[model samples]
Target: MHVARHKWRSSKTAQRGVEELNAQVARHEGRVQIVNPEGLHPLATRPTLREYISQLWARRFFITADARAKALRTTRDYRLWQLWLVLNPLFDVALYGFLFGMLLKTSRGIENFIGFLFIGIIFMSMMTGLMNSGISLMQSSRSMIRAFQFPRASIPFSTTLRSMIDNVLPAIVALLAAFLFQWGTWPSWTLILVVPLFILIHIFGCGLMLITARLTAQIPEAKTILGLVSRGLFFLSGVMFSIDRFAEHSAVHQVMSANPCYIFLTAVRDASIYRTAPSLATWGELVAWSVGAFVLGFIFFWRAEDKYVRLV
Candidate 1:
């Protein structure tokens, strides 16, 4: 009987010890437990804003490489190659010139109407391309997004970069056409301003792209709505004729004068075609629109980075 009681007591103590160990484990507050090997890791969590920016900076080379590759691929099918870049803008200018300059006689008040039309068409194309890139940025990049672990913002950045590079040849061709046809004079010192002006326009475009990218990602239907809205903006932008023609109507004049598109195009024409410095007001408006949009769009997009993978 004594031997049996001793063995039972020993077994009870062992059971009590096991319970205490479990209680200790349950009560433990700061211990680092091993995660399951197959479970999601902490690295999968969303990064901070500063970290996101750093990642984007680190991937700048990827942006450039991707932009170049896409640009080449886009033109590879065309036999004319880069000639299309020059010809497309020229054809657009001719069409608008005939419609607005000939049919409507809208060139009466404007000097060098062809040059004016050229500047407007080329710049508008750049703007429209940038915005479209942003709107379609996510949809087009789904495969990359799913296959890679890079900054999603890079997609839109690369898209904008590609658009800028593509526009370079078109811009050169348009300028040459302006000078060759006596639509505008030869280049001058004022033309140096084109660099800074284009940079500002690009910055403004980046902001717009960010905003549209985020919106389209959330609501795919927004793309169609934005397309219609952009069409309306084209008319308001004075791409075919001078907005100043409506100056007699004070309200219409004020609206068009205040338009960001009109402001940018006018500035370009002033520098490139007229060989004159853009007004202080034009500079101010451009800076205001570009900087404001960039700041707002960047913050808005950055806040939603984590949601993109899931949303897409």
Candidate 2:
């Protein structure tokens, strides 16, 4: 009985020793706190809320934040001067409406010339801003490119976004006027697609701008050439006419349909003008363009990134 009791006590002591060693190991590894401020064991701490939010903002927030800051600052300037952002577009609308819709009576049987002008003008303004910002990005951001290491592509993106925000007032006014005048009753559901479509357009625009900015930054004449091209694109884009009006003529319709900008504009117009979803081909083309442009622009811009500072 004495030998049996000795063996049992030895086994128990061994088990306890093993467990104690494990606890010491864990403390040394910092898995468990060994010392506290009062010379006692401590508890683990977690990240603070501000640190968590800062980490979240650091990732993927640059694109939206930088763009938004630019927009807000620009708008504040105009607002401080008591000049509304929509004033210019509104003035242009009034002048054009009087000359084309009234003086020349060009609208003819069109019930709401003002609404028509607003839509067309807003579309043109958005496109122009997108294209111009993209083209001028490198030139305008020479110092920024030289000094900073953030994504160079984000500059034009932010510029386009800034312009898009600036035009929000015009978009709202345009839609409101159309609804009030009963120009073309666009279903709210159809208009919901505008957000994604605009995103695609913005992506493509940024990519195109990156390529053009690099090209123009190298060759000054590229600017004039691009301006001329933009002018031609405007006329060919069918800002003033509905695609349906040209449907009777196959050749003209086909030519117009082939132009990417025209197709995109028509897709938007279809939703707004006819209150219907666009064809599969329209969605496919926009996706294809977005993917293709982004890939090509990235490759092209990456190659030229090393040269930006030298040129600037």
Candidate 3:
């Protein structure tokens, strides 16, 4: 009985020692002290920018998993499930190919008009999809945003990721349709250039997501008009025809040609359908737009992080 009592005392002593060590480590770890409590932030308060980035890095897996889950459920409501991803592009190709290629005859001066139209329509849809989804992101993730305390940027980032996943089949189909309809030859090295073009375009899309997500949180009604904005961008993006269609209006032609959306689609078409190297200018614009937009958008969105939580 005496030995048992001694062992119990030893165990208690060891437990106290461990707790004391933990306290010391906590102190060294910058544990905040509650002196007045008024200055204390909630446990999940917004971290500093550097810390916020690190948090995002640490949560990369969670972001990808969230994206995967969202991607899977994206088409659940549709009767055809994932086939919509493939069919949607085909439908767009057919409708536009008929309207612009047949009626408007915008396909007149272009080589391999069918392939060009397919690549342009499918690629531009990815961009418009990102903008539309980002504009509605806060509303769609309202419940999760309120219940959790993660970096709000993760929503847009995950959305960008989800877009990448969902666009895979469509992107592949675009290239295949190009080959099947017009560019009938063995794949060339220039075709591989589409890969980088794809990545940069999606990076640009992520930036669009960040910008629109913040805008949406600020002006909830902005969501309604954002779709129209995307459609406007789509039409101006040279999706179904070349910018030469605006040749009579030099001013409109210049603006449309200079548009980053036009540049991106033209780059993919040049690389994939035309099998020609995209100009250094095309690559430069893509890099600048993708990198610049992402950096600027991150700062803009981070500035409004606190506002997202309160958005209804």
Candidate 4:
């Protein structure tokens, strides 16, 4: 019994010594110079906002690429059209032909409603796709949230990028269909600038994605509410009909004017059908919204990132 007591005391003493050594090392760390090329590991306890951002930027590409590729493969398989590059938009155009052309009969004056609806539906769907997929981003990637320690901001970005790829086929089909139908002549050569315009739209989509991802990640119930909101936005954004015809209604005009969806859709419509640039005022609003969305969402989401693994 005496020998056991001695061994236990010795073990306790060693443990106490180790604790003291650790405390001393922690104190000395304040003066010690680190030659770390890869930087120190971030503590979950107190992460500076800037340091968190730096870590995100550092791993942005890999996370973005992996997430994007995963989303694309999933979409491709679900659609079951390996040649989805050709089929997706063609299908959209046909569906619109039936809905808007035959059912609504709203394309009367527009030589070929098929072409007009094709352009509008395809472009409008891009925004809808972003909005739709974005709301589900966090929920869809719950496993990734637990498995990886990268930035949550990358999640929305990857989702938006994936949606943009899906938009490509529809965009191409719209252009070709427009030309074949002569619904609107091929846009001005200046329309080539539309590429960057769509890019801005994508950035805006990213911001919306972040906003939605953060909200839905926290409250899964929000997913259904957002779906309803997106459906309303779909009609409001002039997907099926032109908002220009509603100019006489002051209230509707005002609401449409303030809608970011309207601004973006008009920007795309002007570039493709009217061959003009997005209005400066609308561009300014979009830029402001995009930057604000990203910054706000990043900070909000980052706060919960460490807890995500635990929650999942």
lDDT against the true structure, per candidate, is 0.83, 0.68, 0.86, 0.71
Ten-residue region with minimum lDDT total, candidate 2: 41-50
lDDT of 2 by residue, 1-312 (tens): 999999999999999999999998777844554565676542322234454335434644676777777774555655453256656777877776777667866576554556666777676667666776656568788787777754555666567667667667767776676566764464668887766777777667767776777778788678888888877777666655454567799998888778777766766655664567887878999889877886687567656655666665
Give the TM-score ranking, best first. 3, 1, 4, 2
Residue 87 lDDT, candidate 1, scale 0-100? 76
TM-scores for every predicted model: 0.83, 0.70, 0.84, 0.76
Tens digits of per-residue lDDT for model 4, 36-139: 77876754332578987787789878766866666546445555655776677788778767887678876766644566677777777777677777676677
Which pairs clash in the backbone of model 3?
A: none
C-alpha positional error of residue 131 in candidate 4 after TM-score superposition, expressed in Å: 2.1
Flag the better candidate by TM-score, 1 or 4.
1
Lowest-scoring 10 consecutive residues by lDDT in candidate 4? 70-79
Pairs with backbone N, CA or C atoms under 3 Å apart (clashes), candidate 1: none
Question: How many clashes in each structure?
Answer: 0, 0, 0, 0
What ranges in model 2 sit over 4 Å off?
A: 1-59, 75-83, 99-113, 183-188, 243-252
Q: How many backbone clashes does candidate 4 have?
A: 0
lDDT per residue, candidate 1, 115-227, as tens digits? 88888888887877677777767877778777778778888888878877777787777677666666335788988898888888888888888999999999889999889
- How high is the lDDT of residue 200 in model 4? 72
Better of 1 and 3 by TM-score: 3
What is the TM-score (0 to 1) of candidate 4? 0.76
